[model samples]
Target chain A: MLNNKEYLNKLYQSDKPLIIYKTDKGYDIYTDFSRRIIINKKNLKYFLNIQTKSKKSKIEELNCYVGFFGYKLLCENIGIKFPKQRSKNFHSGVFYKPQTKISIGKKIIIKSIKPDFRNISINTKKYLQLNKKFNLNLSLKQYSKIFNDFSKNIKQGKTYQIKIAQTYSKKGNINSIDLFWKLMKMNESPESFLIREKDYNIVSCSPETLILKKDKTIRTKPIAGTLRKTKQLNKNKALTFFRRNEKETKEHNMIVDMERNDLSKICKTGSVKIDKLKKVEEYRDLFHYVTTIKGVIKNKMSNHDIISSLMPGGSVIGCPKISTIQLLNRKEKFDRNIYTGSFGIIHSNGDMRFNIMIRTLLNFKNDIELSVASGVILGSTAKKEYNENYIKAKSLLDLFN
Target chain B: MIYLIDHEDSFTYNLAHLLDSIEPTFVSNYYEIDQIKLEKSSTIVLSPGPGEPKDYPLTTKIYNKYKGKKKILGICLGFQQIVFCEGAKIVQQKNILHGYQSHIKVTNDKSIFKKNFNFLGGRYHSLKMAEPFVSQSMIITMRCVKTNVAMAVEDDINKVYGLQFHPDSFLTPHGKYLIKKILSR
Candidate 1:
């Protein structure tokens, strides 16, 4: 059998923390997993990531991804179900839609990560250890076996995902998720995830993504206001409080409008509709304003188009899109790179799913860079804005030092 | 007790510590602010945080109730909120300027900056106050150095005061002195 295992193993080598990945650069392939790295006998390939839409001619030639996307395609084509499945939007990066393909037999998946790649001036006093070294002597075969068994359990609903994510830090070492939990304790509805590309290097534990998706349809919910509920009040009072609350609604409505415009490019014009607005949702640790926007795809837009339009979700970007990006770009020194990019799965049929890249960490070889920020409105109190970001930052802070 | 009645704990805590008050607390999370009874407090301090004033209902209620009831002081966002409610205009900053190092001229020494003067305060701010309220008949104890960008206006007419600089911060040499004026009022 012309197996892709050998090629995948080639990409999952030891030594380097990250690898360059772009499976079929000529053709864009759908991949829910963001564990991408193109490894050869000697070198890792370069993949160009673009925020702008590619010309139709350019996109038509691209078909498959270099790393996990290709692995996912091969698995689906071969019907090899993963032995264990724990894919989350937080760490999976950004998947345009959701699709599953698993073979009964074993398969190979290649991944590369450069955990401690770039480092400038980090808040070393506040170090973040973000790596976990799995020293298990399990080979590709054994790992595959475990995955197979895990997939069987998932089929039984033994393992289900309530929240999904991928996170990073400056230091390549993390003691526990306790710090992440601490942030959650401060009223942060944390979304957690784990990933190391091929085998091992760095793993991510994230707490956010304003949206979740299912097939060609999608949803974008921006978190604006927060109120940790202690007791349930009467329905009418609760409704009145949520509706009457001035600050929360403005924060939410702006995001909804922003999301609607985002969905407009890939989704049908009128198809994009706010299914629900300003519904107070209570997750494990935090209560938030979760609004659902749903729309059917209009143009025969590819998954790339959808992801392109919604790269950094609106909740992170703020109200005015271009201005916010430019404003932050001017102030913030470090490059965002993949730090804010999302991860998820792309169905073979073209549907995909992904989440916002909040509560993230970027590991530095000798140190770590974990950061969190809150959106600032015109009348925002300087102290309040700082505290909001600080609360969001707590998830990763308590983890390292 | 002094409640930094806004979020952004790091910044507020830093300012609160500088004030060196008997009791200082951070209250940006509305839930925390709501649960705590404000009846026993001697002074109410509204710290800074994200979002414009019109959105914060709690702050509005607090503003309406306080109405300079207790010795009140507002910083950055708090300043704008209290001033606007007390009837004043807040103009949008045409260009955002965020960083430290002051470019303002404090001409008045009566209101908040009573004693110390002729100084530069470290500041990182994005917004500005336009045409602040200052009493015409009586001495309002306020000054505007827009030619220098930093302006402080006192509606002594309404017993309300606003600080363009973080007076409760050590970044400004006379910051503590300015805050003392409000606290001891």
Candidate 2:
């Protein structure tokens, strides 16, 4: 049970690149101080997409991945072209692909008591700094218009579902490290992790699981439906409400079907089945409907094939994933960066889990941003959908309160 | 006026069109049904909702209040609630059913729904009344073709009906027709 401050101090002090991925029941802390691989756009050539014939080493002893998959990276890799736009392409992912050779000195830490942990002494003066309020990137009207347009798209048979995202930002004289620590304390999620880079920092408590692989079994948990949790509402009542919400169920079922299709790509025929369907998973400030789809990997199917099949998790984008992504590329204003991206670890032993980058706070060039989105269906209304974003943001916003 | 209890289930919205088409004055919620209003209404329709029978204790109270006095039609969760109030126990199925479409074999449709009621029905329930939990006063009218689970129960003596499947959902082949038949009775 590492306190937030201590964890931040240790994170800043460590020279090695590391990743801390918290699971539903536990957390995994991985670090490789002696050897760390950084995957960037420049080195994109070194990487191979899924099922490439130029495949190099098929086995790696111990590989620890400590980065994310940008929404664009997945689109480009999957051969789905995005609409030309002025959006900036910030450094997206820093994946450490499974290497052929053995790396013996890697570090692995597992703690049961909320592993977004490390203990550190706090500076009282820094703690007393003024906190700034966050502001939405789009106003209610703009969000409404976008939501309405998405609903129209759904009606026109353009797409069955499309995830509409909005970013919240705040500027102030603040400490990003302290904010990261506070977020971890307030809204600790299954995929909770803090990534400290030379120029930027990411603090996340994401609730969505993107990709999980263990040996021949590979799975993806796509989260779709959402409802804000409040003190006035009883747990049973809330669960009932969420369960009967037709709009939410439709959104959730679509993604579950999409995830099943994705897994079927590299999975053995008749091996794919939904392990869990529409289970209401309650988080701190919000509750979500999540379904876990699992499939056995086909023989000789490399990790690349699995990632390609399921990169840019369906829940974050939408059904008919590629086309909706293209539509969003033309629509959304700001770059998603690592917001809709994924952060996880691919172990050397072939076990891995990545979290969809929602409920995540990232600081690049000292500017902090957090993102929240709702799945848009034909029945979705403009105001209601936009309001859903605030509900998603409430947990993180509660950190300030 | 048709009194429709709003259980806050999203599927309850589907009942709006069917109810409105039948009665000009439609009020939502069983609590809103007063003695005079309940007497005046054509029928009391319990809208489909979430949760098990016990989760909605109010529905049981309504069932007790107007058992034989008024026409009653319960759909989905409402159906489970009706049977539970009649001394029946609802048990969680080994495999929870949701958004599943299948045939419901009509064993005895001599009560309200038309004869030869064997038709495509859609179910979305995690709990069902199997052989043991069948209500003492209610008759099992229909069962799913696949799981053989109880799909419809009725107590014609009390003028009460329950359907495990949602007749209001588009998945049901004869949903509108079945709803009209139940209400017309």
Candidate 3:
């Protein structure tokens, strides 16, 4: 019997489409897929409908598809169309029907159509480190200009809050598994995940859960306020700061309301309520103000309705998701790719869990890119928000150092 | 039936769900005003949205067309539309309060809000109806206890009501109650 690390290495060397999703307890590794569903603009609705109509498998956990939905795909899903921006033209999203499944929690469990481990040897050294410097796509001057424009929009009541994205890119060969491990050591977020595909790889330490559905119950945790962690600042002090600061409280409130509104679209009336309000989540570099909202899913609501209402989550975009997205699409030069997209699993039983893809590194064709953004409200200053973006990207960028 | 004119706002669905709980509601974008059967609806609800009321001239037209015929209710930007149509200037608020909870004091007991009782409401707007309200028909019903900014207004004769704060928000505990009260009236 192989150990967990050895099993992961074997799967990684297989060069098959794979995903290692981190749950609250442990990791769920999916490999040896039978089919790959490449989602596009035309087939999105069809794909969603099919997934919704899938029959429950005899085995519960093994019957699932693990994949990601890109930012452009989610935007289009919600009926927001924009002119094509300069991008690497990554596939909108891809999902896999896995034949082999491994769950590494208190007990290691493996379920596969054919379990064959012969002729595969694990390397003593699991990963190689790389030293590459990342450069921001937008300079301070450019970001400031965009920030001022967004501020003007906020003042005009065009949007209450908007997130301005900035990308840090570097051309280099990256061992995604190696980088994922290193970043996890530094910042092990709850919604973290790693995907290794033939064409591309995604490593994320995303902290926000856009949607988590089980049967008729659905929940979302919207993270809004961010405070840089210091020697003197702890979770309690950070909570106090978030409570006293009018701007932070207000920003968090807007995100909570927006998320609740999204849930309200598919949730039964009077069932949408805040489970936990204004809680503090501590991370390596920052402390976030988060709120957990739960709702009872309305009868006959399909997976498409839930995904459309929640993807490109409001906490990452802004309040008034539609208008804010339009403003962002107009102002932003590059396609967001999968930055604010969602990554998770959809089970045959209609149970699903997805996380907003923030604090993620996209290593597509050896052009590694890490995108980060900060929420800019009326009281937000350019320099502060600009620096906040760097603080977000610092953990991922430090892996290259 | 309640006719909800969506302003491309995120909270429109929330308000729709709230209104639907009280009465069956039909929602349409403000641009699709011509397509909707406005006469079929007993109440016309203008949803909270981005931008000032001037950006939605069609909503104002609906208010003008159905002022006395049907009950008109507006929230956030919708509230500004009612004030804007009533000959009041919508200016930038001194303190922009988005998603901030404030205690509102009812100034007019004859309106939907109970008099002398303060209640928390969620505010999300950058613009406010300019002070010393010049409209004779529109009466300011509720004002923020701290800022004293106009939080709610109503026209009894025209059966039109507007609320600056979002009653659909969870922050506003009495959100459903307020909606039910307005719809019943």
Candidate 4:
């Protein structure tokens, strides 16, 4: 029997970041770092060649690795040259190999042998108190203008769609682990993750999958449209309204089509198919219209090619991805850092899964930063889109309340 | 009765709303047409959707079933399919129109939709009719004033109508009336 409580206490104080990814039915905890892979200008080649090394290290019984890829990796993977965009508070991307991998499910599986657990119950009442007031880098008016500009671009056919994002920040010294555990208990999602890196801790309750590679198949669940959950709103009415909403449907369909195009590049010819379209997923305080696209990995295509083909997740960037990303870089106030970036493990068996970081809170020393974005198309209104940003961030912020 | 073939387009829900009087039964492109009871419905609607019309072979099959039997109105991509099925061609436009409003003039007012008045229409399409008319028998009902592109077409004999513009979208003024005209026929 492993000492789960003792390990949690050690993880709460560990200097190295830990990754906690909840699988479909259970939790997979990655910690006790051993190897490091930093994606930078110098080691870009080695970083892209990670799949071969991972495959070589594969053991049939136990396989686990965890880290994050920043949004900037998209530019590098796609071979688009860009000037070094300044990172505001966090490192863009890095991967870490954990010495110990723990899987808690029907049967507890602990990789790497070392284990400890103290039979102590944590007081659930002890919670982290955070400032409710948030500081926005871009004013509401400025955000509206940016949204309008993107809409104009859509009208002119410069780009079909662009996602507008803004960062909400608050300064405080809070317990990151407590906040994460509170969120884990309060909100349940398919891709809920808690990532702790050197100075920054990422606590995300994301519901979208950037990419999931299982054997020869690659799948992604892109979540585009959103509806705020409310007690007064009838579930049926909301579902019907979401289905019929023109802007919401258009935004979602555009992402789905774009994702299909992205996957087709690395996937075998005629293997890409939309498994699901605009299915509404209900969360604690938000409703997301999700779509699943699946494709068979081409035998000749390396993992590098697959990641390059679909990085930064199409839905987060927008349709006509390249130009839209350039436009976003210019319009948004700060770099995305690890938000909208993905974090997961590449198993030794050539399997991996990464989640899109929405509804996430990141701690950078003195500041707690949270970002939310929405797709802006031709008919998008600034006021409604502004409200949507808040709606997407509400679940994460509610943990503070 | 209205049989709405949902191509997973955002406009399908709105099109369904416009035809609420008929209580349109919605079926996706994935659904097999042979299994559906299309004979019970008097009208068939092909909902607007993304991608090339030829990509959805199911839609072309659905169009064949209701060709001359049921009164059909094809919207956007559906409109492209009706033209393609009728031996016409659809090509990608140099510039795609998405969520744009345009003024359309009624070219052939003598047809069933006898409104000589110019009206606003909503457009969301990347593919346009390469040839304006499907065949010599088809009438060019409405054309955009700015681009001179065919916005609406009809074949009285086959009872198949096509609208390149979205008349069900709220952006298009008096869209419900157009839906009424198509259904009443």
Candidate 5:
């Protein structure tokens, strides 16, 4: 394990953002102004003094990373195909394309990132020590923005989820906001993140993959049923209705069927397995019907092929893939550049990880854009969709005005 | 120009309806720094969305980039974001609060000169902080109607500010004033 804090200190000390990223169950790479280090699932390879492209920013850049949990896969499967490797070069690994140069405007001095430490665990002691480096004081009032939008979108029938997440823990005392943002940017992983500390800014500027790798380990947690809080309400009945509601059950079944068929694409015949179905998990605001699908990839399938097969997750696109995508095409009035897309990175080794940029922000030069959308089903009402968008817009709306 | 952070059809249309007088621009959340050249025209707003601050770093970057150069307003996460961007901590709450009439108490009138705190109510369901804290330069302008948690905070911190409550929300009263007060500045 590397002292990520010390590494972060080094990046900060030099005022350069380092790019650190990893492939699932494989290798992790860290590129920066000083060095470009690659850490495989086993050995660590150092590639210093690498080549750079003619175009580059003269300023320093830093980015770092900590492994993301598998729960991340559920978010990306929103409107794309399920259980797919996001990056094209995962199997072959190692993508060193046109790099950026930090020049003084005269002689072009090329620079390449270095490779370092290989073995790292989600629960490593050294990782934990390094994780404490950048402790942020996070405000708690944003969830209401989610609720407000949820109410509005629900009324409009734009079906989407309101997920409130917190950094329960940081594995590597890695505290570089710039580094974390940059690492996910590498490979421009669609599900990767870049949140700035100075402005509490965040960006899903990933152009790579958005879901988990291998396409074998697949997941689908379709949401259904919601509880409207009222002064006069029956708790037990509400619980019973939520637990076994009819309408909710139908929505749940539709998604389950939708997911099963998707799994059949990458899985062997009869290999699709249901780990859990209709599991109701209660959150601060509402409840959701979560189902888990597990399957092994067919022996002769390439990750990219599987990726093309499942470009947009079904969660965002709706049940019947074609019809649902078409419905969204007609109903959705906004251009979803990367909001519903994905972003993540592929390392030298084949290990990969990614997420859905649902709660993503588009940062252009003069404009700071925040985007969010939801799935609209056949049973969805216009009011419901509107409320869902409202719920969805809670955080960004709060941040904007 | 009414600068909104969200790109919903009505977010533009309805905003246009509310101010049927102005042609507001509903911006999208996907751009590099050079794309968001939001230099002084009038109002700039950071909109709402899913995910936490860590997900959309660019919005914050853009805000800080134009902090002193423009008159800005943050709604929902945009609200919390401005405070956090100016150096406050954004932590998740235990119990999420949402819906209309979720207004807070305005302890001070630093940015906007408002009187009644009860009239400041807006529709919302969020997880907020206990102490309404801000950077030394910022002043806590308003709070939750009931909890009194910091609902709005601003200060001499580079003419930039934020509101935890929703002003564009159809539910809020005098949202037009709230938006204009910041934009007009």
Candidate 6:
């Protein structure tokens, strides 16, 4: 019998598309998919309307499609049209129906249509590292100009809050699986995952859950405020700081209300309520203020309806999802690709879970890109927000060191 | 039917949900003001949106044309619109309060806000009707306890009302009751 790392190495060496999603217990490894669907601007709406075909499977996790929706597709779905901008022309979205699954937790469980026990020697000694330094797409001066413009918009009442994206890129080649494990060891987040495909790869340490639907209950955990962690600052102190700081509290309040409004659209009347109020979540280099809001799903609400109502989540996009998105798209010179998009699974039984794709690295054609953003409100300063963005990208950049 | 004039704001749906609980509500973008079936709607709600009153000319037109004929209510930007259309100078507030909860005190005892008396409301705006709103028909119904800015206004005889704070926010516990009171009138 092979060990957990050996089993993962075997799957990674199989050259088949795979996804290793982190769960509360351990990791769920899916490989050898039976079918794949690639979505674009033309077929997005058509695919959204199509229901997931139910299959006879005793394993609940196996009867689902695992994939990601890109940021552009999400914007298009919500009737937001972007002006012509430079883009890498990435696929809008993709999903896979897996045939083999392995659950790694207290006990190793394997379920597959055709189980493959064949294994080769696994080398767990190598550490992955990037060969080049990552360069930010925007300079401080340029970011200041854009921040001033956004401030003007806020003053003019065009938008209350907006999140601006900045990309850090470099040319490098490293084993994605190794990188995922290394990053996991450094900063393991709840919504983290690793995807290895033929043409591209994605490794995410996303901390925000955009949607988690189980039966009739739907919940979203929106993260709004962030504080850089120091040796003196602890979780309790961070919570006090968030509560006492008027700017952080206001930003958090706006996002909470916006998320509630989003849930109210597809939820039963008066069913939406805050399950967890402003709480502090400790990460490696920062502390985040997060709130969990849940609602009872309205009857006859389809998966499409739920996705449309919650995709490109408000916390990442800022308050007033539609107009803020428009402002961000207009100001951003490049495509967001999958930065703020969602990644998770949609089960055949209509149960689904997705996370906002922040603090993620996208590797395509030997070029790797990591995107991070911070929310700007009325009282936010350009220098503070810019440094905050760097703090968000630090853990990922630290991997190279 | 309560016609909600959406100014392309994020909280419009929450407002719609609030109004729907009182009566069947229909939502239309502010640009579609001319197409609204004026005779069918019992009330007109100018939703909280993202801009100055001067940006939405059609809403101003609708308010001017039907101020006394229909029950009109405004929120945030909508509140500024009501005052701006009534000859009050809309100026930038010294302290912009967005998503800040403020203690509200009802100034006019006979208006609809008399029921709630004083309460906390979620405010999201950067502009306010300049102080000393010298208007003949409009009366300040509520003021923020901290800033003393006009939080609400009413023209009882004209059946027009405005609220500078957002009643549809989760932060405002009395949002439902306040909307109900406005609809009752």
lDDT of each: 0.44, 0.66, 0.86, 0.72, 0.43, 0.86
Worst 10 residues of 4 chain A by lDDT: A117-126
Instruction: Give per-residue CA lDDT, model 5, range A264-307, as digits (tens).
Output: 55555445556775555443233345666656667776544444
- Residue A11 local lDDT, model 5: 38
lDDT (10s digit) by residue, model 1, range B1-185: 66557433123544555444434543444436743546556666766544445656777788688665655566766776776675565565553322233545556565545432456554434455555455342232333334455345554534556665555433356766667666665
Per-prediction fnat values? Answer: 0.00, 0.00, 0.84, 0.01, 0.00, 0.56
Sequence-dependent TM-score of model 6: 0.94
lDDT of 4 by residue, A1-401 (tens): 32665655655664545677888768877766666677664565565555324542343433455777777765666655555555664665777766666676886566653333222233332223367687877777998889888766665444667788888888765566667778878787888888766666788888888889989998999887888877876667677977788778767656765676567666665577679766778888877788898988878987677777678787787756666676777776577777787777776666778887777788877678888888776566788888888888887878766
In terms of docking quality, model 5 is incorrect
* DockQ of candidate 6 compared with the true complex: 0.66
Scored against the native two-chain complex, candidate 5 gets a DockQ of: 0.01
Clash pairs for candidate 2: A6-A118, A6-A119, A6-A120, A7-A118, A63-A348
In the range A1-401, model 3's lDDT, one tens digit per residue, is: 76766776676666556788898888878877777888887887777768534654445666788898999999998889987698998889988877778788898777776457323544343332243567788988999899999988888899999999999887765667777778889899999999987678899999999889999999999998999999999999999999999989999889888888899889988788899999999999999999999999999898888888888788889878989999999889998998999999888778899999999999887688889999888787889999999888888877776
| Model 5 stretches astray by more than 4 angstroms | A1-192, A195-241, A281-287, A331-333, A347-351, A378-380, A399-401, B1-185
Each candidate structure's count of clashing pairs = 82, 5, 0, 3, 162, 0
Docking class of 3: high
Task: Assess the local accuracy of residue B60 in candidate 1 as a C-alpha lDDT between 0 and 100.
Answer: 76
TM-score for each model: 0.41, 0.60, 0.95, 0.68, 0.39, 0.94
lDDT of 1 by residue, A299-320 (tens): 5776545654555565665533
* Residues A1-401, model 2: lDDT tens digits: 65544553455455434455565545544443333445554444444332112323333323344567776776677676665654545675765432221111233322222222343333442323234778788888888788788766654434556778888876533344556557767777777776655556677888778887888988788887777877876667666886787767666655665576577657765577679866777777777778887888889777667777677777788756666786787788777777777787656555667778888877666466788887666555767878888888877767666
Off by over 4 Å in 2: A1-18, A24-26, A32-62, A84-88, A96-131, A172-177, A232-235, B1-185
Return the clash pairs for model 6, or none. Answer: none
lDDT of 5 by residue, B52-139 (tens): 4445677777787777776776766677667767666666554343333565566785646665545554433344433546466778
**Over the stretch B64-92, how does candidate 3's per-residue lDDT look in tens digits?**
98888999999999999998998889999
DockQ score of the complex predicted as candidate 2 = 0.02
DockQ of the candidate models in sequence: 0.01, 0.02, 0.81, 0.04, 0.01, 0.66
